[model samples]
Target: MPTALSSTDEPTPYAAPGRVAAARRAVGDVAILFQFRRHAVRRRHLARVLSLVFCAITLGAAAVPALCPGAGESVGTHAFDIRLLLPSAWAGILVLNMASAIASGGGRELISREEAAPYPVSPTTDHLGALVLAPLNIAWMVQAWILLGSVSYSMPGNRVVGSEILTLLWLVFSTSAAQVVAWAVEAVRRGAHGIAITRTLLVCLGAGAGAIQVSGNATHLLDQVPTRWFIVGAIDGWTWRWAASVAVLAVATVVAVALGAVPTHLAARRLPRDEARMETDQHAPRPMPRSVLGILIRTDRASVWRSVPMRRGVLVLAVGPGLVALAGDLKWSQMTILPGLVASGGALLFGVNAWCLDGRGALWRENLPAPATALFDARMLVLGEFLAVASLITVVVGGLRAGLPTSYQLAALLCTILVVTVQVVGGALRWSLAHPYPVNLRSARATPAPPAAMVGYSARLATSTTFTSLLFSGCAHVPDWRLPVIVALPCLLWSGLRLAGTRQRWQDPVTRARVVATVAA
Candidate 1:
């Protein structure tokens, strides 16, 4: 039995360092388990699993160079100069790390923040600790270790050791800076208005980046700078040069720590205080029409138009056409790619997660006397209409910019659009059935669909777009019969898409049950 005595007596046992460390580890392990459970229970568990497998493969590749003797030199030297490639690789990896963090819902755990708050850790330290332990950090650490191995492979003992130490230091600095960006974005996205403003700014910035990319001005500017200087300057055997490089790195790290710390503290401090707001302040919603198509349209409009991610996703679909029009020298063939890309992108944005948004409540629709297949068909119909309108706008704008197409060209363009639309719709529907994940309508940040789905859709779209563009580019060179064949195949395909989509979406009881369970919950 424990007895509380005087006021001077301690109320509880002090948490020892070992106990504290063990508790932190236990909490982290639980958090990881929770993430796995969350993904496992989703309809798209396979996609999430595949995504994890892919990341593991990537990390494995990075580790091989470091863990195996002479492997780095063998690969790095045979393919390219290790020294020359290291700096660029480091910079590229840093960008990749930040993108991954953003894509993976910033890979942050708010629970860690809450847990650490009562401890001796300050907000800044808590922020840094979260980042350092984050799964995303594994990628960058592998990159740093790979660099160290490359240096060890190419250099003598002292230089190798020095380079390794410097690489580790730089990795910390770069990753800390990335954490700042991630936390700040998370803070902004914690509010509806902030998400809208941030996403709009992002779209504007993306347009600017696209313009710069196409103009080749950035390449030209980069060429003017001697990028190899830092790599070459740092590892030179000269003691003074090495010392200067180390000094420069030290100064940079210090500056980076400051940069990362300030924003992190500010963002972390603001995050818990942010009161999430919804975008329900629309002008009185339009009255719902009686038809199935009308009901589907209303449901989707309310879901998408008010949501930040869906709205922004819709906005991004327009970017393809804008870029095509703004292109300095647009080829007729290149103009063909815009419609397919836009259609595919639009389909992917809402198609994959729409069913999941209705979670558990979907069973309510089953009781309405309308077959589940009808509901699915109605959804497809509504989505098809949206894609059709967007595709038409893109084609019209592109054709106008290209100057009115001749009869043959117009026919070819129309055929291309039809083919793309059918393929995109069919793919989206099939993919949606195969992989749906729960999404919260009320959440400030939109649900992050599995990375595998995003990558899979993008790759398929890019391949199809490229093939169509190249095919159309050579239309004048291809036999006349081929154009007629191309026109006929898509029309035939379009007619069967409905039957195919229906079969995939509603054919199996298992699939229906899973979707029903997901929707109802």
Candidate 2:
């Protein structure tokens, strides 16, 4: 045992260089710590299994063309040469990645800043964590699938494998580069008048893109994009060129990863003025609602609109994919997919854990002299409205670019939007009641659920919504108008049954208490 020191004994001073070296050595350990904590807090066997299955599916999709080279060749003839569009596809994906990163405030966190406040986790760790979690977004995954499918279909037989490799490299490079840009954007947003400046910049960018499209220079501009070199190198099948491109992208990825930390450090040191302002704003009292349900609805709406994450998420969900559709000049058949994507993203914002939006206030809300069913209905109503507004905005934007749709196409699109919204709302409410998680959505980087659980939620939502969109897309081809209605009825009925079940469960005192206690914690 060591001898006890007197009051005169002083503590040893650590060398600055040694401390720095030690911190550098320990930076990566934070990821391991988060993983351990996550697994310990919740059993993730199911999430892991689902993740593996998804990976297998992604690989299988990519391998199809290689396994049977003649399969994609049998597809229907295209109106224009698909090869010329390859560069645009690549450039579009890169833009989307960057936009998503920026919108998400540098991507989702493995462990939120609030949760990690007691620890010594560094900004570098946060940057790494964000990079790791970036792939969980449904938009990112869907675009990646599209990229793979496009490359396999566009490239010649022998060059397909090499092109696919290059595409994968580009995906990695783009994601890393996007993270760097996102960190820089976050840093800027935390600066003076950051919100106004960022909003103005976004408007300018959108206006510029629109002007280019309107001027008929979209194709000419896309052809001149640097991404064309990747396709060209693949098509040429020149080993030296391919190797050089890979080497450059790899080195660039490393550079991006290192450069991202600088902004992360700067942003972390600064106060998030936008979030602070939103949280601290004083709202004047509104006139009282006649019914208890109306009061609850008002509160829920305010909760959603006030949250930084929800606002940013809604804006991104409303605009990002719609802009993509507009740029691509997607046909009515393709436009059917936009609503489902937007609705799913909207629901994931806070609906998946609806009660958590109230945080500890959920307990107070529950104690109010309101019927439990009224409370449930109010939450579901707000969620549905949120999803509907976001999805409708997306549809309206896409419609600007898509010329007049036939009656059948319009009917199919409308039914698809309504059905998908209902289905997503029902599923989200059911999940919220069945498996509630306490989430603080005040921060821009906060997810509505745990990262792993979000992965599962996003996967399920994406599958169902995508399948629904595809069905509606097919229905648009049919001349009969009643076909969409007939299909939508069953979907509505199924979702209604789900909502009824969730309501019944929520009405049970025991279940309600359990949910309230969990979320209020």
Candidate 3:
């Protein structure tokens, strides 16, 4: 000012060196928070992961009493085996986390195409931010809780700190490993290959691996040594061992980060080109099938086959029976429950997402002369056919495995079919009509149904399954009489409720329009 300096020529205050770094970190943190919000929008993903997390914690907590030392006894210095119970419970969680990450298009930064064009942050910073947030996923929390339970039951109060530190290191390693797998999968997707075939094969392999891990002691390989060492170290209060484990884990983490960086860099480069191309492709009009029923079936079927989220549900239907058969001792009680659970469970899942899967296509369907009931019914019809086929196969195979008579198997199959049909059609359609939501149908990226809708749908399925379970159990017992009545009562109740909901939704054009508009947007 003394020299009357020009506006651009004024001497600037020297920014503190630490302040610049801190400001950059703050920017990255905000960017990640925004990404997390967008990532959490899908209620379906959260529901599944939450349910599994609950189950894992429940199992771990339940095991604590059994595993804990008796009162007045010092915690054992000997190693404990988590392979017996914890692996199967936690494996499902790990698989779900990995699958969800891959479906959501990998563990890349949350910046959108518009913001990413200029790439405000360097790739190194962007990737680091993503890795930091990777563990923030609820799945990592599930793993953390499992470790906490393990440590609490195995180590005395004074030694818990070292155990917890070890647990944290393991969580970091697991999250980093899962992120690496996700990045690798995303890289594959962006590679020059048939997307469908590669993805389908990958899905199958993943499902198979997850099943093996869940149904068997596959995690024994990972858990056998460190788990034992950590338990022993915690019990012995060996701080040096804990420190050494942390050092090893740090080295491993650096290696994992380096390995993951390749894929991250590749995906980042590929994402812009692929996303731009996709944006162009999305602008084109899509062809609708002739009949309303055909449109419903084809559209839903295509989306299920093409999209990873829908495909995952479908895999549950297909893989569950085989898993049950292979894993079970094939006793009558177990087999009797298997068919109904698998059949009804699959239908319940399909129903949960039935209406939501329509996505932008809802706009086209809404303009049709047909009523909402017709649309709902058509969707149910497709689901019903699938259920019928899957249930039949499951019942027959399960019956054979359990050595049940043909007549009994038929009765079980018929009962399951009727019960699932009524339960899914009525409960699902009714809920769909009552609370319709939209999702991205065309994109292969996973989109979860709304949280409220998921909760409602889950409640409906649970109630329906309870009634249906009675009938299913009755069928399994091969009742000489009263099987028909067993099935018919719930069927009638479900159908009546379904009809009531359908009619209500059908009569509300405003709600229907809202659903369509929400989906289109």
Candidate 4:
């Protein structure tokens, strides 16, 4: 039996609160630095070097147009003025940033929640880490380059310097604001009936935007956009108004960053009901497949569909860019690029680490008495089918807005779909075999590879796909339909050769054992 405590021996009531506060303060304050250190330690030297090199190249590309004389003057044709395009470009970038932030259910993480579970990683830390990692995305980087290029090429020579500064500030402000909104959205999404509420809100927003476009109010809206002030301020040069605008944006960015943490904290406190439900739900067994290949394909298909990230990514890849294309009413020449972009995004979902979908079960999978080639074939088939379906959806949606195509245009578009799907499949399989990382796809925020490696992979894929699409885009202009067919043959042959090589490697017993061991571990 314990005796009642005397006044002098009473327990401190504030002890638990004090400890919690201290842990929160300690981790959130240095979270970015800690994450950076961990990443640096884990990442390979070659990947680090490649990422740095890519950043340098991207910066140089963005800067060149501004530095070159007459670049801005050369942009406008007699039919279209550069100034008229500025507001739209600015608006597009902001929309892209917001869409990206919202789609990831806030933003992608530098360190996943599971990894941070051992530490008292505060919500503020999680938010900041997401912000830091946002720029790693290929789409984000491409849009940034476009925004900078547009600003550099549209502004007058003397005004270019001021406009560039203004544009960069706007980028910061927009990204911060988007993050704040994303956090709020995530907070709401974790509440009761949140998924339905959020889905309804998104649908409403999309419908309203579509209505605005359909009713011919888009131009009127564009004219009244706040981005116009940035242009006006920059063009006027060295004025109090310009200085004030810059100051306001800086303050707003600070405010947005701070405000984002509030919602992040709230959201973190609640359970992720949707993800939890998904992970816990039971599934009825399907009828048995007749053959080994059929069973393997069915298993792979289920894996792709069941994973949160894969499902979300596939939906976004299928729909997001297509909506953009539809709104713009892009021509066949321009539409040829969509398939490549869609395919690249699809491959990034899980194709790059195709074998890792099996996770620790890879060893069990390898021991099954089936032909090794059958396993490889199943994965490839599933991946290719996944990509092809997404690419087809994008094309169909965009084609609704695109005018009827000429023979040459039609051939180019059809061939583009085939060539890009094959190209991505071959490349993805090769990378999956050569460099596989074990990643759990159960988390909505999980990446198929390490962030640093993902950067490298995305860069290579973007470069190759963009070039291939451009080639096809150019081919769409030729009068003869046969030109596309002729061009596609070489690309198909190259991709086939690569796939064959990957298959050969997969058949080898030693290499197969090593991959199985690594992924399983």
Which candidate tops lDDT? 2
Candidate 4 lDDT: 0.82
Error of 1 at 240 (Å): 10
Instruction: Give lDDT: candidate 2, residue 307.
Output: 80
Better of 1 and 4 by lDDT: 4
| Candidate number with greatest TM-score | 2
Q: lDDT of each model, Cα atoms only?
A: 0.57, 0.83, 0.57, 0.82
TM-score of 3: 0.63
Query: In candidate 2, residue 228 scores what lDDT?
Result: 80
**TM-score against native, each model:** 0.59, 0.91, 0.63, 0.91
After superposing candidate 1, which stretches have Cα over 4 Å from the reference? 1-179, 185-279, 320-330, 338-348, 385-414, 441-488, 491-495, 498-510
Q: Candidate 4 — which residues are off by over 4 angstroms?
A: 1-44, 72-80
lDDT of 3 by residue, 286-345 (tens): 687777677667756654545554454555555556554645546443444554455555
What would you estimate as the lDDT of candidate 1? 0.57
Off by over 4 Å in 2: 1-14, 18-23, 69-83, 156-158, 403-406
How high a TM-score does candidate 1 get? 0.59
lDDT, residue 88, candidate 1: 61
Better of 1 and 2 by TM-score: 2
